[model samples]
Target: MSTLAGEFKSAYSAGSGDALAAVFTPIGTQNKPYRLQSFYDFTNAASLQKDLSFALFHGKSLKVPRAEQTAWVDIFAAYWEAVGELLKYEQDWPGASLVAIFTAWKKVANALIRGYSSSAGIPAWTLPCLYTVGKYLRTFAINADIKAAPQGASSFGFQDDVAADIEKNAHLEEAARIINRMFTLCLSDRAPMEESRKWGIYQTTNLIFKTYFRINSVGLTKNLLRAINAQSADLPPLEAFPKSHIVTFEYYVGVIHFLDENYAEVREDAFFRVIGLTQLMQAEKHLATAWSMCHRGASKNRELILTYLIPCHLVTTHTLPSDQLLAPFPRLEKLFRPLSNCIRKGDLVGFDKAMSAGEEEFVKRRIYLPLERGRDIALRNLFRKVFIVGGFEEAKEGQTSLRRTRVPVVEFAAALRIGTHATGRTRIDMDEVECLLSNLIYKGLMKGYIARERGIVVLSKNNSAFPGTGV
Candidate 1:
């Protein structure tokens, strides 16, 4: 075995493919000194150190203390080297050899990574290795001529070497299997629940998922999220992760939930730390804020726009004036300022116009659906504003100077019709206005009720009309 290894090493160094092939040739006999092994033997042996070389594209490295960290990196390096050499001989190698090579490297590398993560349950080193594996899989898919069908094709059009037409794409299936294996580790008990640790895991997993998604393997995202959520109690505080990871994970996960039509989940997870804003460009922040608008993000859409998106669009956070920071994003101001004011002032009609004017831009940015959901928030704001502005300060005879306010529902409906004319739209229906008020009351946006006989809204004065804004 040592003699053959020596001959293969010399040939590989001298670029002698024929000689290396001859070295790996199986000589089967009962009396043979030992069974001839191939790439499998090369990978498991210490000689991998000598054969290793870094690839052109790089994977991130981190300060981690896993055993044989250098050895693992070297193993990856050697795998790339073997892949490079095989490419040179690809035209000459038999078809069986090509498939065998792909199968052996993929299987061995995946098992090695899964072993480390499973054993230590630490994402520190395991996460970095996963990126390299993901990169390799991407390369493998391209080289194999694997084509990704449209996202919801139900069946991957590509197939394995098998002649059967009914089989799914072998490459996609294998990659997904490997990804899920590592993903399950993130939910394990000892898997370091710190934010930074999980951040690494999520980022690397997203990268792998991106590759898999190209081949129509996105259905697995829901499955993977279910596993992670099942273990959410075991996860750490998100603040422990660097702000950058928090932003990225939230964006990706939110989008997945959005795609899944899980609107509430998307909204709940839209809370973003302000620290990561510098890491993204203005357009990127714009897109994220647009996504947040979908569910009003607990009514923080206004705050997100004010604190992050406005600063990004107008001047960077660095140049933001203590006075009127939104000078640069004038167009954004035109679109959202009225909406914000309407939200604050209970001007539903104006809010509707502002939303209409920005619809084109929002659609162009692909945030229309999410932003549309902001209507509920606008209604909430409008209701609060109307009760405050229109409520009368009347003295009740029997009560200790009770301040009573009563306004007709028709007056409320008129305010909702304010900006519609600009868009060539007609006045909003009275029933629609009543229905919206019903929702506002139901959602605790105000302490009020419709006096159906008189067609008026009577608001309570014991506390502020808006709920949760304690004075």
Candidate 2:
């Protein structure tokens, strides 16, 4: 008890926010020095209060500064009180619900925020402690909502319940409101660059971004972007923040654009070197960077980056992931490798089968629509083969030999039959083949003009037959 009190006093007196944050941080978080579990006997609230009070107020060795005494005591008291409730909730004690625990923690977070805002000296550094508190408030609210649902309810059923009753997840909604307050507090800070609470902006935004996403309120993310953009001139550069913050912010922003179907923008922001690349090509670069940045740690983050990257790579570059790339993530390989092979071989029938096999997972990850677009690329590859087989026209003397650019529509119809694995008795339709070719042209996957009257596709000889690929 004395040692914990000494450490807390030492951290508080030195104005080391990081150390103080660790003191209040829960167990299981990385590198946190003093977990609440280490000091308080959570099973007994009376003993917990006595130890917390002795640590904060009554100990002979503990000496809180007079000017800061009130705020410090209030903050620590609320924090331990909340921790006591959290322990009860975790053990599923009678009458101890997530809602009650969340309500307790909110007071702790509010007390810290109040102290930070009211005390002008060195409390700015403790802003991360505020983030830790707000993060759990959101977490507990989510768990509370899950607990409120009927036993064995499907995720879709819970979603339907939420839609039918806005109050079903009221705790989560309330958590969001408090996190927004945290966001506003961080954004509105006018302190000097070095001492500013503005440094906490992205962390707070990331928390709210998570909350909004969990509650199926993705459109709200745009308002967050707008608010940040309005204050960008006054804020620090994104690169200046910790890599963890930068990586997470970029990830959410990337997903936002991806969900809006703005693949080009996602790629444009990835790297300046590949400016004119296809939309998904750029998007893959962006996602690849995110993957590389976090590849050394956090397997979950790496998996998420690759989950989106593999589909983008297929649709834009007309390529498949090598074994080396997919080797580290077996689930991703299982989800994508078959689709990759099917697209590469122009096996439309196999592609449909692969999609069906992984439909549940793809939809769950929200990558179904983007991945479904790979069919067009498969069609493009199939037609490229047809063009290759058509070969060059024979040249007359004094005339330069040129490759044949005009392909009969019958040729595409035949390729479609083979790609689809149609039986010999199955008849192919020329009109449907024309419709397919038109779609390829419109999407720039193929560079050609369809001459409906002549029943042929006139490829553009000026550039490669396919836009991105040389062939």
TM-scores of the candidates are: 0.49, 0.85
What is the C-alpha lDDT profile of model 1 across 193-229, one tens digit per residue? 4423454556555655555555444556666667667
Q: How many residue pairs of model 2 clash at the backbone? A: 1
Off by over 4 Å in 2: 1-4, 28-54, 57-67, 90-92, 119-122, 154-168, 262-288, 315-319, 422-425
Query: Alpha-carbon error at 9 in model 1, in Å?
Result: 17
Error of 1 at 431 (Å): 2.7
The local lDDT score (0 to 100) that residue 36 gets in candidate 2 is 58
Best by TM-score: 2
Candidate 1 regions with alpha-carbon error over 4 angstroms:
1-78, 81-127, 135-174, 184-219, 225-370, 383-391, 396-404, 425-428, 468-471
Worst 10 residues of 1 by lDDT: 157-166
Candidate-wise lDDT, in order: 0.49, 0.74
Collision pairs in model 1: 294-370, 346-382
